[model samples]
Target: MIVTRGSRLPLYLAVPVVVLLAALPYLVAPPVTRTLVGLFALVVLASMWNLLAGYGGMISVGQQGFIGIGAYTVLLTDIAGVSPFVGIPFAALVAGLLALPTTALVFRLNGGYFAIGTWVVAEVFRLVTVEFAAVGGGSGASLTGLSALGPTLRGAVTYWCALAAVVLAVGVVFAIMRSRLGLALTAIRDDPTAADSLGVRVTAAKRLVFVVAAAGCGVAGAIIVLDSLRVQPDSIYSVQWSAFMIFMVVIGGIGSIEGPILGAIVFFALQQVLEPYGVWYLVVLGLVAIAAALFARRGLWGLATGGRDVRFLPTGYRVAGSQGGVSGGGSP
Candidate 1:
């Protein structure tokens, strides 16, 4: 049976249920809880990257472009007189919308070129913002008014929102993988030329995933900016965002939903323990990712789980000519 991307349970049921159950922090509300919220946000960003690069075969260095857009979207919307909570979704939408044009330029390249193009695009977006001195320019902008809400409330709100965004992103990806389009995407990712020969529209699938990934990044970016109450072009657009993403996916296990989430948990713990190491933090992260890529080609979970006995994502699939599409059949 060919259980491809198009056969998972509705991600809506899984993602939101987990997110709601994860509301442990709202009750406890501590510095540790806030850190966990922050960790989930990174999980969102990293998972999106893994989905894009791992499953979709699109490694984008410019995911931060959407990140900045999302942050700025929230900032701009708040300026237009909306509450921060409302401003967040609005920002995410705007970032997703902006990705339309950006896609045209970046998709013009391929492979390593494509990755570099994304980085350049991020820099371009950052530079444009910096040039607009009215909005705090190079020094960056602030979310000071959010602070007025009080630390505990602000933290809780942002944390919940982050959790929500992560759920939304994960759900969307899971759904996409289950749709016919996702079937097409899986083929393309595995072998673009071969898939194209078989009539899958590789370019369009890649583009759709890119836009979806961008939209998810927007929510993540907005939540992060809100939490920081500041937005510096350089920092928000830093290549480090890409680095963190690569670290999580590689170490956790690229191309699996569980991988990035697991990777983020490991990453956050490593950060807490190595907080005093300063620059070494980055070095350790790089080493971890590289080691995984070299030794554990399928990722940590792939190693631990040992080849497809379980899929949190149950892709519905069937043998090409079966009487019915079977439930929970795995990759073709």
Candidate 2:
């Protein structure tokens, strides 16, 4: 691989830039500002999927399990008299805590089994939520009070938090990957047996990634509930949640931070443009994903950057010839 002496910007500078970019809709157009926040929420979910699936070698189809946990955490906490904002962090912790046993169950499987196991977990959670009638149970629950505050302010707050979640997850993933743990993750991804032989603790690493992803995904779930101001166990725990995450990460240039963001942009843009087709919209999306997975390899950005990942977020440090061994060989 040809080395690129890439000059990375300081995270201090990048974080503010990303945060400002997230707030763009709030500043320029008060109307639909919340939509921008929603986009960031999707990015947060996508980032978690990317980290878990892309780097950690675990493709989960049931990440919504934690997402649902987060939503209910907020809803349940609000019922208990805590502020919803305060409940958000608490919700994330709740989700992470819930992840412990689920890991034991799901970890028993590998590859496609692991993926399917995740979906089952999401489904089970959905069914459990349906039994609680006071919270609307099967009918779902609303994020009532916050919805009454109107759009602009809620949009601003959610946007900030969503951006922060994305920033936080991405930053943590970047840091861990740059540190010794990052090296371990890379080794595991490349060859689990060799990584294990090197004493990298494969299962432990995967479990850690899963838990962190669960926490971030939980926050995203809270944001989604906030966005719709409602939560139906069925809707929140739908397998489509996993489907969308897969779509965004796969087409966005899977296994990389930049991939999900680009995929989200393209996914949303396509949705806006082709949504009139109803079911056909999904057909087109599937076809695009199929094609990207089969031929493009690195995704749309790969094509745009000539296969070199030039990150605007400035998250990690790439030593000379450190990554991207195939084809173009980076910035040269």
Candidate 3:
């Protein structure tokens, strides 16, 4: 048997799924289309968080900082005479650049302190954005130029953009996790001191992960405002963004790509059903997350998959026989 790290079966399955999703705009009703736009954005957020905390061993409650910044980037750039559509990438770039200095300051702490430090940094971003008055300050603002487009055209564009963001976030992560950098990330996550001693350049790998995760979150933030046509400092920068990400990653499975996808789906389903319940929905979500943490530490994906090492998006390495016969397997 040709041993592989990730299951080729998932790749085969993805072909038809991609085709179906591509045709979804035509097939689904407007409500479904809108729901999917939000869904894909959640996937992007959860995936980025998973990359940062699960693989890179950086637990950050501050990712909402990037999301708020990214949303503001879209709004501010649009105010500056750039199309919000074009500004999405620039938002990612700015968030990535900002992460360099942010990381420089926060990386000084370790363990739980590091986590708290990230939260503090995010609050600082939120507060700073509030003072900018032009972008609605703390009051928030609506995206203006989009109204020039017909409703149908704007919806279609936003839907497609959301789809693209999802693909980009997941694809970038899959590509990274399959490369040499993935190996370094795994080592660093597992044991930083050992990885460092073995010349793994732990700090560099963590920093790269930080930047990429920030960029991904930035793109997600842009997508959110692009679809909703509104950006608010409080709503976008709320710690709830980080909470949702942690819930998805933890309940789905932190170390695996499929986990976030599954987690987002589950979370979305709950949101749709229980949202009317207001505070009760949050209570339920918290209960579910606590249950997942206590019972299924590897997450629901781990429980569903059992001990089988099958992966849809394989990022790990495989040991193979020279003749492509039966052999053992391992992750990168």
* Runs off by more than 4 Å, candidate 2: 1-16, 22-26, 309-332
Q: Cα deviation in Å at residue 326, candidate 2?
A: 20
Between candidates 1 and 2, the one scoring higher on TM-score is 1
Give the lDDT ranking, best first. 3, 1, 2
Candidate with maximal lDDT? 3
Residue 264's lDDT in candidate 3 = 95
> lDDT values of the candidates?
0.79, 0.78, 0.87
In candidate 3, how many clashes are counted? 4
Tens-digit per-residue lDDT, 307-332, candidate 2: 76566443344443556332211211
- The candidate that achieves the highest TM-score relative to the unseen native structure: 3
Compute the lDDT for candidate 3. 0.87
Candidate 3 to truth, TM: 0.94
Tell me how far the alpha carbon of residue 19 in candidate 2 is from the true structure, in angstroms, after superposition: 5.1
Number of clashes in every candidate structure? Answer: 7, 1, 4
* Alpha carbon lDDT at 213, candidate 1: 87
- List, residue by residue over 40-131, the lDDT tens digit for candidate 1: 77899988898799878988888988898888877776676677678787877887788888889988899999999999988888989888
User: Model 1: residues >4 Å from true position, as ranges?
Assistant: 1-22, 316-324
